[model samples]
Target: MTKKRNMWNILLASPFILAVLTCFIVNFALDRQFSWSLLTAASCLYAYLMLYTLIFGGKHRILFTYLVLAILLIPFLYIIEYTANLYLPQPIYWTTRLGIPVSLAWLAALAVTALLKTLTHANGFLTTGYFILAFYAAERCTNNRIDAFIGPNDSWSLSDHYPILYFSAAALFLLLGLITTAVKRSRSRA
Candidate 1:
């Protein structure tokens, strides 16, 4: 029974492990550069732990509250960062750079929150699936609308390859969601 329980634990954790590994592989393959900030890393680690606990630690209500808090905090944090950037002496371009790390932290929070909620609610597949759809829609909308705000002198072009790239990413997330659902279902049957 102990061994079986261990196996179950491993199975339950596999999706998150796979997601982390895939992120590493993609980062390496794409030669993407990411700054390893301590704050961001800590946020991610805490989020992961909270998510795991929320899913399997029997603290469902507390975890759900944390998830809700995280979701609400993300936009508020962004606004704070934006306000800070405006008052600082740094160039406007630096806002994007500074914001990216904070945004990533928020995104990690969101993902973990979602994962916790989905697991507890037994709606992992639906939550992840809809998240992808929402992401795609937001990406499309942002890409189309952003051009209007940028001046001609701005070096950034809204016509870049982001739309296709984001669409492909959405597809990948959808596939991952499907796989995670299958795993969860199989585990439940065992």
Candidate 2:
């Protein structure tokens, strides 16, 4: 893609970028917090941008900038969880308690992105859903269920064999990506 096109993509995705950053500033500004849906959507956009940059950016400054900013976002998340009196989901909250850096979380996210490879060529919906669900499953398997930002209320413990949930979601993602690729190829052939 041309520089202009890349710029346009980043510009268009700026809302999501802002939303992700808001996790840092939100405590000072708003009484209410962002919903899980909103956070998940922002995360998906961030993941999408990162996936694009990592896979197809190729010396493009614009895409590289996006990727760098996304990496830098880890610090902002850290600041929010550490400095700000904000609520974090149980899975993430445990990380804070365990002193696991957000950079590691980001690295885990990168590994997920790279492993799936669906984010590179799939439609936005497919990619976004995959990213969201994959992370959600990770969160689930870490403790067994998704929880609110404050903490988990359910009995989702750390000892449960929730690996099935995580792996099943991953397999579903691969299946969807394969189906999409097959359809696109068939369309072009026709």
Candidate 3:
């Protein structure tokens, strides 16, 4: 059983690592100024993971659901980024762009949900709370460095988007958790 679980973990993590490598390769090869490669790689990774989860049946259904939710959320985040670019007085830095609020939120959410799923095997509000706390800590630690590189206005304003994104991601994961639990309960009765 332990070996089986380890194999599952490797299977689940493989696509993510591949996606990261894809981004690196694209970044190095294209030498593009924009970081679109990362986004593209992430999209591809999410899609691959979803397919893998749906076909193989694993503990990653919740994570896959969050990935799907994050993909759905990209448009909304792009809207915000576009709108903010238009309304804000200064030119928006690409790095600090507020385009995908939910995507960022989803990252925080996913991290929290993964942590909870690992530690307690529970998917409750506490998971969300941990996500929020972790996000806050991360924001605090990174804010200064980000501001220094992106400019103070860009750093301060865009930073707020992270927590929101994290929460949105967490919500998706939580929803998936609930659904998975329901399915398991039903199957057990049968």
lDDT of each: 0.54, 0.56, 0.61
| Positional deviation of residue 116's Cα in model 1 after best superposition, in angstroms | 13
Question: RMSD per prediction, one decimal?
Answer: 13.2, 10.0, 12.5
Please report how far candidate 3 places residue 99 from its true position, in Å: 14
Per-prediction tally of clashes:
0, 1, 6
Q: Write down the worst ten-residue block by lDDT for model 2.
A: 141-150
* Model 1 misplaced regions, further than 4 Å: 1-146, 150-159
Model 1: colliding residue pairs:
none
Q: Write out the backbone clash pairs for model 2.
A: 88-149
What TM-score do all the candidates reach, one by one?
0.30, 0.37, 0.32
160 in model 2: Cα distance from truth in Å?
4.0
Error of 1 at 117 (Å): 6.7
If the candidates were sorted by their lDDT against the true structure, best first, what order would they fall in? Answer: 3, 2, 1
Question: What lDDT tens digits, residue by residue, belong to model 2 across residues 8-46?
Answer: 778767767676666546633564555333444445565
Displacement of residue 173 (Cα, Å) in model 2 is: 3.3
What is the per-residue lDDT of model 1 for residues 1-190, given as tens digits with 9 covering 90 to 100? 6698678667766766666666556655665642222224334445555655565556475656566555545544554455455557983543244444444544564565476556656355546555655555544444444443353334443225455665566567667767787888999999
Q: Which scores greater on TM-score, model 2 or model 3?
A: 2
Question: What value of lDDT does candidate 2 attain over all alpha carbons?
Answer: 0.56
Q: Model 1: how far is 115 from its true place, Å?
A: 12
